[model samples]
Target: MMLTILAIDDSRTIREMLRETLRNAGFDVHVAVDGLDGLEKLHDIAPDVIITDINMPRLDGFGVIEAVRAGTSHAALPILVLTTESAPDLKERARKSGATGWIVKPFDDAKLVSAIKRIAAH
Candidate 1:
């Protein structure tokens, strides 16, 4: 089965990059402008994995993770935080918020795909 991914970011370029990368890797990619939009799309898409930016308008990655974890249906879904922040505290906070993994921005396409595949396999 083709896995579906929901990628949320404020940057259009990042979203486009993720869409292209994931699509080329044979995954269905859906995108949202921010965390609020991500939450909305979450219900509609029921994606196998989610990639979200840490800093954004409306809501942020932590908020998105919290919201997803609050719900029963998608609570167990793999959520990867894609951000420029590489601070250990930030990563810890993301983990506390229920994120499955972390990827610093300017990510390697191959590593991203591998991470997604690994998470989806679980």
Candidate 2:
């Protein structure tokens, strides 16, 4: 089965990059402008995995992770934090919020794809 993913980010460029890269990797990719938009799309797509940025308007990645974990329907979905910030404290916070993994910004396409496959497999 083809894997489905929801990628949320405030940067239009990052969204586009994720869409293209994941699509090219043979995954069905959906995108949102930010956390609020991502939550909305979450219900619609029922994605296998989610990739989200840490900083954004209207809601951030931590908020997104917490919201997803709070929702009954998608509480177990794997969430990967994608951002420029690599602070250990920030990563710990994301983990506390229920994120499955973390990737620094300027991500490697192969590694990102591998991470998604790894998390989705579980």
> What lDDT score is found at residue 78 in candidate 2?
95
TM-score of each: 0.99, 0.99
Candidates in order have lDDT scores of: 0.97, 0.97
lDDT of 2: 0.97
Clashing pairs in 1: none
Worst 10 residues of 2 by lDDT: 37-46
Model 2, residue 99: what's the lDDT? Answer: 98
Worst 10 residues of 1 by lDDT: 113-122
